[model samples]
Target: MGIEPKNLAGWSDLLEQAVKDTLIPSMKTQEYTWDTTDIVSDPKRLAAFVALSSAGESIQVGFSGEPSDVASVVSQMFGFDDLEDAGDDYSEILDGLAEIINIVAGALHRSLSSDGNNLQLSIPLLIHGEIVIQGKEEWVAHRLTIGDNNIDAIIIRGLIQKQKD
Candidate 1:
């Protein structure tokens, strides 16, 4: 079952903190804007998502960008000097994306689940090529722009609430 936060404001602040900590750890935290950019305009765009669940609610955290752009961000995370140094390994890039989501979700889970409400997480799922994400339209989703990477990160809070059967 998904764990729903009784206080939405507090939950949003935590989510924002997770995003800032995960994406901009090196630099000063910047304000994130509502993301409306079309990432799919680039044919090589890719997306990765990780599922997070608590006693009351479940959420998915995702990142979407062109493969090259994502590599650049991942390279930055790994202390690579430049995008070229990160190379064109799709497997590595996707793996890094999953790691990023994992870290962020883990942090959020820890803080919110401290009240004896365990928050569980699933391995991240990467989607590229022709896969269309179904049932996402009904999710309580938000997209935000982080830094200058030109990628949109998606946060989706699930509407279904039930303890895992």
Candidate 2:
């Protein structure tokens, strides 16, 4: 059976903490706001992104931004000073972001599974280019800035049909 989720406010809190714990302390976090930015439709297209699957994938989590933005956040995550695109290593940044997503997903899974369903987190999926998160009806997005860079934090969740035994 699929695990059920509780009120998303709890999930959102954990997500915010994951970002702060994983990427803060290394960069000057300018501001955080829970805003509905149409990142998929934005011209910048967030350059690169990472996604995590829920138990049965009824929920989805994503973080995305330009290579420069990715490097800025990720460099800080690894305790490296932010650098320009000209000197940043793409692979390292993406991998680090993936790891962060994995951590966030695990936290969400555990909290959502109040019934002790033993939900498992999926491998972080890293991708480049434009993408859209499914199930927007349950979405609650937030945005944060570190230096001049901004990244989108998204959660797309919805009702999952009960599985037949």
Candidate 3:
């Protein structure tokens, strides 16, 4: 069993709060949107690159620009050391993105879970390659807008069970 419907609602509420509490305060978020698409073709490869070592199912979230920009903003918001790219190793860049995703997801999980239980999160995976977003017959596309930026968060509700079977 992974996250449930009722729990997913909780996640959504928490995600909204996280944006207000963390991302919005730090950056001038413009036109934000929440949506989910199938990971059909690895929409963003950077996310997957970061998660390769962690072996956990991943959900893709699309933001604006390159890793550096995202990293810089997130680092400042979280009060962490600036992320620098030493050479071409993208792992570092992906690591920063993962952190942001983790924060958002963790916050959502906590808000939804009973007794404030923490949800286990896999290391953040960064997908950099071109990805094709498509919806299945049973799944319809969903979207939400915040500020000027479009935030896309996908949910893998029964990911664990799917993997097991």
**Top candidate when judged by lDDT against the true structure:** 1
Point out the worst 10-residue segment of candidate 2 by lDDT. Answer: 156-165
lDDT of each: 0.62, 0.59, 0.44
Superposed on all Cα atoms, the candidates' RMSDs to the truth, in angstroms, are 5.9, 6.6, 7.1
lDDT of 2: 0.59
Which candidate has the highest TM-score of all?
1
**Local accuracy of candidate 1 as per-residue lDDT tens digits, 72-111:** 6777677655544555557778777777778877878777
Cα TM-score per model: 0.70, 0.68, 0.51
Model 2 sits at a Cα RMSD from the real structure of 6.6
TM-score of 3: 0.51
Error of 3 at 100 (Å): 1.0
- Summarize candidate 2's per-residue lDDT along 41-97 as a digit string, tens digits: 433333332333434555557777777777767776677764445453567777766
